[model samples]
Target: MSTITVDLNSKVVPAAQKIWIVHPGRNRSHIDTFESAGVVFLEFPALALRPEIIADDSLLRQRIRYSTAVKANKGFVRDDGTPIHIADYPTAADTDVSVHLRTVKHLTTRMMAGDLVIVPGRGAGGAVLFGEVAGSFFPQKSIRAAGLPFADTPVREVNWLTKRSKLELPAHLVKFFEKPPAIAEVGRDRWSEGFFDFAYDAYSTDARSWVSLDAPQYDGSDILSLVPPAELLALAVSLYRAMEQRADLTGLDYDQIIARFYDHDALAEAQMRFQSPGRYNLKDKDAKLAKWINGFVALALAGALSACSNGDHIEFTNKQAPNDPANAELTAMINMAGQSAGGAVLTKAETQAQHAQSKLGMSAPATVR
Candidate 1:
């Protein structure tokens, strides 16, 4: 069996506030092992997900052509074995029309930044949309009808954003964007599992640095820490729809196949670096490189979380920390201690708790002692 743990650490975020979660590894030993050959670990600062609302809906509908309705089978009704549209004659199955009304209601709910929307089109012109960019790109105007077969074609999908990728997107894609469902609403019982699925499926070896394999049982007893990639490039599109915006999804399976199979050699190289001795320990020359990598991750996240002068340009401008004397010393110590037994990976809850207590200088209580 294998196990994977995701630890979320912040300046002062407590366990209650923190979003730490664990997942069972691929090979389940009674359904609670973190052993998986193909798993990824993802960490994105909460700052990136600042919530904002869509101010313009008319403009959104113009560009994405989402307001256009597509015909869907209303299903048949029988009056003495005669088929008819629900409008022609209402019946028990007529309740099905309620589903469409509910869809419209759900779509009108408050839109937020980082939310994804999709729009369908002609043969190969399906477009994805981001709610954040809708108002800007489609500012109220007569939407130039992009002559595509999409008009009158019914779209079939959900209109919402989630932190975890369905299957194609590596776990990191969702992490870099930080669109997980609200924990309070989802409840703690299933939150960890749901979050784990998001973190695991949204990242890939091609674009993300960490992979998680197994699901380890977590009792929330210890502090598990992970150093994930600091920089990420994700592709999210924006579309205009129903005087509003919607998110589009391309097949995640296609994206994953392209990254994992077609680009296997390059992705393999990236993953291999994870096992190099200097990766975990920062004392060696690789430590500087690792620091550089860490700096990149921090900068990317900071850019996403911080208000940008121009949202399109993301700058990673804080790479000079290595030159500072105090930072250099700290890096050296981290490398040294990290290379020791202290760095050895431990999975059991007891082991993790003991490690956390030791680091905090808190003596084990009478019972543990």
Candidate 2:
């Protein structure tokens, strides 16, 4: 069989940055390495792969399968020494072997040096550590004698950038860490990923910017130009939920979807305000515009947020959204807006988000919904 070699001295341009998850071992078995060492480890040490085999992904998987056949598995140790060696395969067909292969292979070959890894439940208060892969891959035992923590397994040098408490992050981000794997990648969920980028400072928009409840009133014309009030209110719902819960939303559905719209709209306005301040020059700004705008927007979303899409048009008939926090919030917004506008901003429950999108020129936002 053909073999490959890993060149320690080689240099190549790393690909676009990717975020990964590297568990801190089963029962925190590998937490020591993560806590004290500047590296991350993926433990599937059955193959004891050589430099050449580690370099060739196909060969590596083949070897992993081959090792699974060895009745006495040494890599997975049991509590007692006598029980330490056990059958590695859970099934005769080895149907579940793909995950292990994928994990090891990713650590050895697929993961570039610059890729980032998320090690959860580490540091004080079990903070999530965001670290970059600073060095190239090293197969099990190659760096063992080098005294690196958990060097007996597949190893990668990491430069931990920052750590945040699980409570301090978004709900979606915390939910992501519940996955049980030595290694995995965050899925391509739009909102979760967007929040990840935001939480990790990847968006260039500081996460702190989104943490506030205060939104400056926009001139009715200028703010409405960025996003129609109704859509903007929906987006605000999502943002408020995140800000209220300090969590990345799982999915932007119903009221959640409303929040996503507000987020984009707000981002557009923020850019205009900070990046191009001239466009944001407020003229006779209605200080309570937010109150009135949100009230109208809430009125629209209340009837249509949960409507099922029907071809091109949607039925906005489900209006009595009692006991829903979003509904409650909408009610408050409507009340506030009415108080500000010197009259009720209430509208008939006649159209859904789709109708609003089409009528109001709402930017077809990319949502996690």
Best by TM-score: 2
54-168 in candidate 2: lDDT tens per residue?
Answer: 6765666666664543323443443354333223323232445667767876676667776767887843357677777786765543334122233144467788766656555
Local lDDT at 220 for model 2: 40
Candidate topping lDDT: 2
Off by over 4 Å in 1: 1-94, 116-293, 296-369
Give model 2's clash tally.
12
Worst 10 residues of 1 by lDDT: 234-243
What's the lDDT of the predicted structure labeled candidate 1?
0.22
> Model 1 over residues 108-212: C-alpha lDDT tens digits?
332222222321111122111211112212112121112322222111122222222123233432332232211111122322322322232121111122222
Runs of candidate 2 exceeding 4 Å displacement: 1-15, 55-93, 122-125, 140-151, 194-369
lDDT score, residue 290, model 2? 30
Give TM per candidate: 0.22, 0.43
